[model samples]
Target: EEPWTLFTDGSSCVDGSGAGLILINPDGVEFTYALRLQFAASNNEAEYEALIVGLRIATQMGVKNIQANVDSKLVANQVLGTYVSKEDNMIKYVEIANGLVSGFKTFSISQVPRSKNKKADALSKIASTSFAHLSKQVLVEVLETKSITGKEVTAARKIRLKARQYEVMEGVLYKRSFLTPWLRCVGPLQAEYVMKEIHEGSCSMHAGPRSLSGRAGESQVPDRRNGLLHEMDRSKSGGNDYRRTSEEICMGQYCMPLWYSKRNNLGQRTMVKSSHGDTPFSLTYGTEAVIPAEIGMPTYRTTAVDVVNNDKELRLNLDLLEERRELAAINEARSKSKMTKYYNSRVRGVAFQPGNFVHRSNDANHAAAGGKLGPKWEGPYEVTDALGNGACKLRSMDETILSRTWNVANLKRCYL
Candidate 1:
């Protein structure tokens, strides 16, 4: 029997979370679903939710074979056993997906580009926004919670609050302190947040635990003075410090104040040398930046400018900019080629032909195989096709093709 083909997408926004599923049966029957989630969820979570629902729907219809497509690379990789689901919520979702896959005689899930899955994407967005307007043919379901068991939740809670002496009041933890009646306590999950806000921040003092505890008794004077000290210290430093201060002043003066912007930072990257041994900026602009000192006291390039010839020279430089850029590109490519050769010299390529039995790396998929004591390689899959570039398609001994290609690095020959 031909397998059912499924395309799934998910959307999560401030309004709500939703999932869309498009299932096509072997008989050419189509089933579409738009699920509006009542509970809060991330994009990846919604993706998994949609896939689980789609798989259940297929199983209910007595469909034994399935081919699934998802726009979420993480979900697709996790389902294909190429990526490990480390987060507790994600692990639960993966377990649920695995259970659903086991029920089917054959199943495969592949990652497709978002552009190709526009219909599913639209359905997800629509379900998240106006669920009431959805067609009757498009089934709408609500997932109240993720696939987490009460026992698992209880265990997680126990682990999170393990040996910590604190009392919960209105969803917040409070711990008794000698200095105060009650001190607000943070959980394991909140540690990073507290660190970011109060300690390890751009303006934070970044004090050691002992130092921070010592200063906890001080008045508000400490915080105010710390900020002053930080500012003063930054202003007083020399070398790169002066350059940073100048850049900051320029940004503020120009009203382009994005301190942590990556685009602004990329502008400061040093230019690589071209074939003529000139920096990219020098080759294009025909001159390097004139330092403040050089401007105050004239330098060779600053003093030697003739207005009559400057216009002509500027035009000539503009005309040669494309050639300079092309030369830089060629130089960069040659450097990359040399690096690739050095890397390939150390690499021992593993080659497998069609019909060859191989075992896949078990690093991520060992959870179901007794974990620590499990075999290093999980499969005795037969290579169905060589996908070139060290990738190959595989099928299980049961004649079920895998959803994605496996890299040669992750596979080894398995002699029967």
Candidate 2:
């Protein structure tokens, strides 16, 4: 007989609030179970409790093989050893879940997004409030069919839908952890949300009403009354934690390099030590453009440098100073790639002349204030004057503020 899948979920009001568990068996048995855990507990604790109780019921039913689907990515990942659970209450649940896994001859846990887990999610919500005890387990044969002819029947490996960002393929979870967060839709998720490649590193889904900072980039700040009015309205509506939009910025120099010149499709570049006549490898830059696939990305100077050095083996520089030098080498390779990649484009090589409008690097404050520089390359600054070399003077559009002359590598063309 093939293994059956049990989908379970839990819900609770507070740390010590009401809790319940719901499980469904694919073979047509539907079970609604509830238990109020003593003492205040977290959502994770309730989730763990639900699973334990459901597992106990399955074991009693003589089920020998099972796949457990859950909506808690953190718990799922923790069980799979991909992430560590740091909470004290969660640790206990983790240990219990592990023990149950060891005891079951065939058992696996998988993560699913909440959208794909509607039934279990609904059951959990129902369990949270109702105290009705369905004394007997409900069983209904969902499907049964066979050909009368002496024909052979085969069943393929089952693939269960886990969540919006995950799926169970042959009982293994393929978790895609990227989510597009909406600006106005801010709050803690009852269940984990998976982030995807498109959204990548950005945190906010939609533009926030408030102009959170002084940058004055693009916004309707005055009309939105900034974040202050939004916060007050949210508070009056019973939400006290509403605040500014979530921001994510990447920074670092040799410690974390940047990548550019991806606008043109030359190919990707990498910097690394080279042992002559070996498979070439490329190191990733920290500031990389999240471009669509099939676009020509630039290649690094590592391949060229390795050929020149006749170095047969690649080794990462460990000493801080040595690493800094190695990083500089990689940065140079990246810069050359970017410049060469964009040399002939309609956009042309980045050039700044006097009176050009430009936005400072996103991390201007951080880098200038020693707060950790975000994307090192900055500008759109107008060229005040051509400086003979690969440099030009710049100025802000609004303030007419003059900026120090910058190298071509430091400028990026303005884009809306």
Candidate 3:
């Protein structure tokens, strides 16, 4: 039987601390867990907690001969006896982990690269950002205590803010400055307005965040569609003035003859080597359209009046119309084949199988201040369904399926 595999990762951000575990059974079925820590912990502490919890889960499932993968080299080395846990907290965590490890008949811990452990990493980030609820196939748990003191209860303390120079007025803070009477502290909404004005306002210099004083730069680039529209408006200014004049009537009449002459020239060119060597007018009525020159100066065929034989020839041409149309269809297909071959030769072909991870272009989903340094791709979405001809449906790391399928040209494989 194949050995069970466990992948674990941890995340500690300002939002919260979280642990993620993915257990794959011998049958290849998976069970995912997103654990949120209610208590305070460092990133290393979170990683250790994730490993301990995952071991406990595997023990409960009666798993034997298991192999565990973790992205944290510190945790993996400590657990494997390669590194010593010197800190008090780490020592306690290591003991708890070893105690859990003793439950399995055979077990091994190995450190893997972050790229290979992305699913677990994503889950840990999600747990840190949001409260993930447990479902039938998935489990989410809250740990109130650190692994070192599993049963210890911690007391909460309330701290008072010391802002002597700032006063709260109607839920808004105002700072007292020597130069000014009082300066209103800007909230996120006000800050956003200020940034927008600085970046894109008519009077303001169109500068990036890196150029702005004390402002952090965004990862997305600015769109150039507005600049294109402004250029188009400038080009149409002279034409706009001419549109409101009596000269427009004269121009319209002058353009009609030119248009008609162009159309007649195109029709004559098309008839020169048509599928059946016959002009469209001749094919329709079994007689060519008479030109003005032919009417002014009579031609031999135009003057001829052989009505009896003409009727018989007209019947024969009418009967051959279907054959001529079929031949035209064949020629059109051959032309399209050549075009398709040429197009394929110039463009590289990319095919993605279902379950592959890929990053999509971020052109349609840029943030307001996402200057030139902004991320060019948005996701490492999984290919859930491959709709042939270079189209595929994608699902995000969070399990949210995108509404539209993306073309392969707009997608690139993600290594991590």
Candidate 4:
């Protein structure tokens, strides 16, 4: 016996959430299901919802052996026990799915990429959603049967009916009115509302009164205590510690952060940076910051602080400051070059030719939308021009050439 195949995909968007599923039996007939979820759900939740519904349908149809396919790697892995479900919702979803799988004698589920599962993916998308930014997006839905299929009915009733006055003109239902040539028939409640609005001349008839209770909440300032930020993450940098310490230091319960920040900043400036192997204070002021303890203890530098000698030393340091900074810049550049060379060595290079279609990394495009969802790569842009250098020009799907050229590193070729 051939195992029935089921494909499911879930869509969550700004407008609405929906789930679409298609089931194929041994007889090779496809039964497609499109569902509009009444309740609010995330994409993952909708995926599980669709799967559960599909499994329930297959069970009702008395299908024993079945193989389910879903595009969600999370759902597929969790069901297969390859991934552990940490979230409460996902854990519950896995449990529910496992229970359903136990009902069938031979049941298996596997994950497929979105491209391979086009039919379910098409059905899963709602009215307005796009993988990339686009002016016009198309969503395809195929159905085997027409929704309305019947011939027009002949008048059979002998009694005077309300339908006699109604007629369809340009697909608009109109009633034969005595006062007017054709009056559009409407529900009694809507007709009453429209007549009232017209008669009353709208004076607060349309927009209702604004209650003070609603505005009273807005008038009061929100409780800052309730919205207090929690320090959840700890940074590895010492600068964060300096900032926190500056905030904590107080004089008689009054925090003198500004005074504390001066010391912290001086300490930070004197601290040796790994990049240039030198202190920022020395690089800026042409001399290291002398500690108060060093002055009190009479160090060699403090003892040598003659007015004439100090002036000459300061002038000499200032003259050599430019040379010191030039060395620092060279060191920083060398370090960066070493890192870049190492990175490039490990990376396998990808080259594009003319007429080649590629996807630019969607990092910048989707950085604001930093969620796990959405495509990581943005286009199927065509390569128009390529220079000997790593720079290239691209053309969009509309055949419009982009003004800005991109580095070859950012361009990834489309496999298909």
Candidate number with greatest TM-score: 3
Q: Which lDDT value does model 1 have at 393?
A: 96
268-346 per-residue lDDT for model 1 (tens digits): 3223343335564566465554323223333334555887898898788788888877876788888788889999999
Q: How do the residues 253-357 of candidate 3 rate in per-residue lDDT, one tens digit apiece?
A: 000010011122325421423334445555455455543422333334445546778888777767987776677567767777888999989988799999999
lDDT, candidate 4, equals 0.66
Q: Pick out the ten consecutive residues of candidate 3 with the lowest summed lDDT.
A: 251-260
- Put the candidates in lDDT order, highest first: 1, 3, 4, 2
Clashing pairs in 1: none
Candidate 4 C-alpha lDDT tens digits along 1-416: 78999999998888667787999999999998767676778999989988998999999999999999999998998999999999999999999999999999999999998988888877668422543332343455899876555432223242247668767765546556332234443433433333233223222122211221121112111112221111212433343232333243321111111111123223445556677787788899897666432332233345547777888988899999999999999998998999899998999866778889988877744523445886788877899988757788999899889888888877788876
- What would the TM-scores of all predictions be? 0.33, 0.30, 0.34, 0.32
lDDT of 1 at 109: 86
Model 4: worst 10 consecutive residues (lDDT sum): 252-261
lDDT of each: 0.69, 0.49, 0.67, 0.66
Regions of model 1 farther than 4 Å from truth: 132-416
Off by over 4 Å in 2: 14-26, 130-416
Candidate with the greatest lDDT versus the true structure: 1
Model 1 CA RMSD to the hidden true structure, in angstroms: 35.3
